[model samples]
Target: MRQAARSYSVQLAIIGSGMAGFAASVFALDRGIKTAQVGNTGAVAYTTGYLDLLGGDQHSLLTDPWRALVELRQHEPRHPLARIGEQEIRTALARFTHAVSEMGIAYTSPGETNLMALSPAGTLKPTCSVPRTMLPGIEAMTQGAPTLIVDFDGLKGFSAAELVANLRDSWPELRAARIAFPDLPPGQVYPEVMARALEVSTNRDRVAELIRPLIGNAGAVGVPAVLGMHNPDRVQQALQQLLGVPLFEIPTIPPAVPGIRLREMFEQCFPERGLTLVPQQKVTRIDLTDAKLRLSLRDSYGEVEILAQAAVLATGRFLSGGLFAGRNGIRETLLDIPVTQPAARSEWYRERYFDRRGHPLNRAGIEVDDHFRPLDAAGRRLDPRLFAAGILLAHQDWTRQRCGAGVAIASAYQAVKGAVEVIGQGSAATRG
Candidate 1:
């Protein structure tokens, strides 16, 4: 493949293909600024795609997401200022829904929280909301007290009977059973499973068909994590028309395709506007100068260099490689920026492997300013022109709070907006 120009005049270089990268590209492009997007793994592979505003109860974080940050800030002082509040979180969710919808992806709110849904493996997934496409209109059925757990045959990674037994331990009085469907793979790799399902089946309709028998028997219909097909609108219509019960989705296994699909939509939309997409290209070095910022990227084709007036580092956490770890422990990838975490890696976790309480891995992330710029050990900004977004610049635990997507959106927006201002001011200086 032909290499990208060795040196080009670009206004901004947004790294990572996740929400933060896509959001930054869109923001920069909207300002008529030239930008390039490069990253290793695309964010979609690990994202749930739903418009996550505040994870869990809005009221939980509303009173203070900053509480954790406030304490950490005194120690790290460089940690990014979290702009999320109860009301701001609400507005951000609304804005996210509108933005993605305008991109032609339809979504609706489930209006409930801490609900349960089914995974393809016939297991229970306690996802955040009803989700636009999957949740059922089962409230009426539940009045009769029918609780249905939807299932898919041949799905790996979970057991339906185990799920029911677990749920029964909690709500013994609610009537619930597993309903199976066809067409899912008996054994397949995660991505292949996702690609096949996206191509051949309608998860929504299959879920509806399975729950149809229990329509009146159960007041609510729960589906495997694969409840909705890739199409949100179709999933919604199917659930609405099928069982007259409420529907919910759950997290089942690793490499969730539903999450991947959502990420794909954002990635595809970015290039349509002329945003340069460099997949699997990892940035090896970053040198910031008074005049511009320079990046050296390494890929299979070898080293490809790029320079920009400003940059957005959205490469994500250790799992994504945006943050690096070794005997020295975890540190930010690009600048070796200091990270806030337990001095000993052992301090990073609770005694229980799955404590559900905050994990050290979640806390081990970069510290940034209110505008999302990384800071140095001295408590000063690393680069005035540099900005960090997404999980790379961290504060809260996304998985526990269920605000992974929310953090991605809020920080990505803040980074892009800040980049535009700095780039615009620099451009005017050069023209002068």
Candidate 2:
């Protein structure tokens, strides 16, 4: 038996639940726009919880992202970050981070210089903003303070010894320790389970007791990012109080706790603020009308529809199913939008795997105009009310450049602003 299709009407419909989609919802909410967002679990959970804003160019790591933006504009004017002014990008990042903080995850304010954030592999990456809980480790690493990095007995992927070995030369005082998580039956430990368990005061106390004995002369302790999922700042602080030392987290491998924390926080908080969120569902079809845009999808209940005055496509690249790679060519999954890509698959990659110049395929994406509107092959706007943002936009390699979150959030802000203007104009015309 087929269930009848359910429907929702809103001023804005955002497709994609990644940083770009979430940022668009935040921007729209600030402007009092009614919004409904739909997307399957995307690459948001793969994030390190670091908001990178133009970390560097291909040649070297950037110290000052603002200065790099100037160089980027001169060299890669077609790049999405170059298309938007620095101030607008700055404002967008600030607003998005601020909202996330307000929603229970505390993040450091974006600064002029990129923070040397710790990665799961013990490498340092230049990032604009970090979770407040992870900030102490950045400072501890910078100062070469005596720090103890602890790993759980059964946790995979994060080796405290490996991190210490890689960083020992740079940070002579760094040390590593392994401890058992409180009350866990272990063959392998999962970060999500440890993070949730730590939310309980007794579990936090038990873990803190184990870490306290291993601290030695270290001034601070670093652990994999398994601090409480909902209130990490509170958990970190509570554990820090018990251990009597500053504590920070190093990012764990993908499907990491910090990324999960952000996803869960937004999912829980967005609805409270009036967003009609359709979490973990992909929009199967879209219909564009002169008056409104209609989106179709399915949930556990069956068919669902979303009608909106404007739509923002934050659908991410290859991994997120926004862009599909065919044997013949790369393609935009939805709307059959023309993608700006290399002529052939052979042209996608350079001869060398680690070529600094990057591959042509990395730059393949849907083309957008000045207002962030998706453009057709003939350079015409596909729809005035349809806008695009995030990694799906053409030009610039996000991975090599290390500007994924910056491009996503900043472009989403611009797209939402454009959508607001279009919707407002439409409303005025109807009243006339």
Candidate 3:
């Protein structure tokens, strides 16, 4: 049987809970806007905990992302990052990372140059911000310091040997070690489980004892991101104290510890700060009226609805189920908004898999105007009160260019700014 629908009213409603949606909420909160955010479990868990701004260009990895943005603006004006001034992007990143740190997880503030962060595959990627637990690894790698990359007996995906082998040419002092996690059967292990276990002091002591003998003369120890889930910095500090060595984390596979920390932190923190957060829930229906927007969805409890003066759509690309690739063509799942895509599906991909330009299908998304409002077929705003953000905006491939976080954060800041303006006007009109 269907349950009674519960409704919420707010000045701004954010759809999608990925990096962009989260960033929009942060911006709105900073502006003192009453906000509600709704989204399904999206791509937040797939991240490496490294916040990437402009990390790469067509063929080369970028160290100075600020300069990369200059080139991007000249070459790709339609790109989401290019649409916003670099100062706004910087401010957005700074505010978002600061908020996350305040929530419990410590992250490095965004800086001028991209940090060479370690990936699960042992390859280095350029990223703007990293968790404090992972920062020492970057320093260790940069100095070619004697560092032991450790892996658990049962942990899969992240291999110390693989990391050592791939990085040996560049960092001759790198070494690999294996240890057994305390009180776990020697079967397949997971990062989340280890992270939670480390939160307990006894487990931290045992694990540190096991890794201490293996450290030898290594200046630092790198482990898969299995530090305490809630307070990773504290956990790393505790473990480092026990081992008497600087400790760092290498990113594990998808749904890793760092990503999980962000998800859990936001889910716990946002509501405390007065933002209505519907975690792991999708907006099933959206009804736009002249006065307000109505959003409907179902949670485990029952039916839920949100009515807001303005809405920001940060629903991500195909992965998050925001943009769907149909047999006929691509589509914006909610509202049937027109998606800017290739004329034919046949042109979606190139003949070669390793095409330098990337697939045309990746660029498929909804078009937005300067205000970040979604446009119709004639390039007119679909709704004065509706705004769009994140990778869902058309033009420029994020994966190939490595600007996912940059586009998401910067566009979200603009979207929230637009929403604030529209909501203020609406309120003033009602008063008049």
Please name the candidate that would achieve the greatest lDDT relative to the true structure: 2
Q: Indicate whether candidate 1 or candidate 2 has the larger lDDT.
A: 2
The lDDT per prediction is 0.62, 0.93, 0.91
- Residues 27-69 of candidate 3: C-alpha lDDT, one tens digit per residue: 9989999999998778888888889898876688999999999
- TM-scores for every candidate against the unseen true structure: 0.76, 0.98, 0.98
In model 2, the Cα lDDT at residue 123 comes to: 90
Decoy 1 TM-score against native: 0.76
Better of 2 and 3 by TM-score: 2
lDDT rank, highest first? 2, 3, 1
Candidate 2 displacement at residue 219 in angstroms? 0.4
Of the two candidates 2 and 3, the one with more favorable lDDT, higher being better, is: 2
Tens-digit lDDT track of model 2 for 66-179: 999999899999999999988899899999999999999999999989999999878999999999999999999999999999999999999999999988889999999999
Off by over 4 Å in 1: 1-8, 26-33, 42-44, 47-91, 109-130, 137-147, 169-195, 198-216, 227-230, 235-249, 298-303, 350-361
- Residue range with the least summed lDDT across 10 consecutive positions in model 2: 283-292
Model 3 stretches astray by more than 4 angstroms: 1-4
Local lDDT at 305 for model 3: 87
